[model samples]
Target: MEMNLVIVGLVFVVLGYLVGVKKFTWLLAGYNEKRVKDKNKLALLVGGTFALLGIGIAISGFAGIQQAETIMFVAIGIILLELVYVNVKMVE
Candidate 1:
């Protein structure tokens, strides 16, 4: 299956924006809305950073920049960490 990195990057960008704005909380099953809604600097920071990285990756993909795949992977890893961070912060 051939997947376009640009599309993947866009998905991340949208997700980042949603997460940053706290609009993606509903996607988390069984997670308390109040906890998720609480102000979390770390979560916001990670989401903003994810958005920037996604945009950079998308630009790199279109520009044929070398190591774009690596950036994408890094972004993916950060997002996974971001999820854990969000969960942890919410419970605290």
Candidate 2:
């Protein structure tokens, strides 16, 4: 169980990175003429959140708590969806 949680946690983190990088690249390329304050903030917020999430999952794996790991999954999912929304807004 612990090993599985660790692995699943890592996957969530990678997925988060994938989504974030995609959005960041698009933001940078599409808004080259703009100030890019929001883009920079988004990068920092999303990147830091994922880093913390990955570390939390790793720690939870050591502690062996299923609930904590599940919460992490939910958090990751929510973050993913939020990123998608942000990307859509950027297009408008």
Candidate 3:
């Protein structure tokens, strides 16, 4: 099993929960509270993305997938898309 990936994935999942469900927006990187147009929307979008990404990583790790690098690249792509979307639509 890919222990490293599993550990990282769990970290992401915890972060997601803290930011999304617990409303700990301060944990988010490069976040400016005053700049976000809607805090709830931002949390939901980013948190959901992180959580899903974590789940994917965890599953890949557990399955010992040979294409782990590919999965990571895909996850990075998704995160980039999320960043663009947040910057364009959520920021003030």
Candidate 4:
């Protein structure tokens, strides 16, 4: 579990680079294909949020905290919702 969380963290960091720095719009899963009005802002907010969530989950897992898995899954679910919002709402 700890290793898995760490792996997810690393993936999020990579996603931050791809979505935030590289401006990769298609990386997100939503069907909304609208162009973003402010790519940099969206990138910074989503990328940073994901990065922090990933790190927090990893740390919790490493500590063997009870219910950490549940928390992590819930957080990931929330992130997915955010991704949809970014697609459908944040874009032009």
Candidate 5:
């Protein structure tokens, strides 16, 4: 359990960087533009969200195994939604 949390934390640390620095200001710049854009904003949002999830998972993982499942589901659900959206867009 402890190991899982450590892994999650590391992943989130990378994600937080991606959202907060790498693709960050670009996301905001997207809102300022006039043309339609498939901005990286969603990536930043999702990454940041998962980063928090990782934090929560790290906290809960310390408690018990069952706690990790909840965090896993939430993260998986978010990814699934994004996948579905992407697939539907592709079909169009």
Candidate 6:
């Protein structure tokens, strides 16, 4: 089992919970309060992504998947797409 990935995944889950449920928008880097059109939407989108990604990572780690690099790449791609979507649609 990949302990490191599990640990990282747990951290992401915690962060996602804080941001999505606790409304800790400040945890997001490069986030601007004034520029964002809908704070709740931003929180939901980003936090949901993080939570899902974390779950996937944790599961993959526990399953001892040999293609962890592929998972990481997919995660990165998802994040990049999310960044673009947020910047283009959510930001003012």
Q: All models: lDDT?
A: 0.67, 0.61, 0.87, 0.71, 0.59, 0.89
Using lDDT as the yardstick, the better of models 2 and 6 is 6
1-92: candidate 4 lDDT, tens digit per residue: 56766676677777767776676746766524456777667877777776677777767767766685687778879788887777676777
* Cand. 4 TM to true fold: 0.67
| Best candidate (score: TM-score) | 6
Clashing pairs in 3: none
User: Can you list the residue pairs that collide in candidate 5?
Assistant: none
lDDT: worst 10-residue window of model 1 = 25-34
Which of candidates 3 and 5 is the stronger one according to lDDT?
A: 3
Indicate which candidate wins on lDDT.
6
What is candidate 1's CA lDDT for residue 69?
62
* Cα RMSD to the true fold for all candidates: 3.9, 5.7, 1.1, 2.8, 6.3, 1.0
lDDT against true structure, model 1: 0.67
Clash total of candidate 4 = 0
Q: Which residue segments of model 5 deviate by more than 4 Å?
A: 24-40, 65-67, 83-92
Q: Could you give the candidate ranking by lDDT, starting with the highest?
A: 6, 3, 4, 1, 2, 5
What tens-digit string does per-residue lDDT give for candidate 5 at 17-85?
676457653433223333324446555555676567667666766655655556678877875785565
TM-score, cand. 5 vs. native: 0.54
lDDT of 3: 0.87
For model 6, residues 1-92, the per-residue Cα lDDT tens digits are 98877887788789889888888999999988999999999999998989999998898889888787788899889989999999999999
| lDDT for residue 13 in candidate 5, whole number 0-100 | 59
Q: Write the residue-wise lDDT of candidate 3 on 22-80 in tens digits.
A: 88999988999999999998998888888988998988888887677788899889989
Q: TM-score of every model?
A: 0.61, 0.51, 0.92, 0.67, 0.54, 0.94
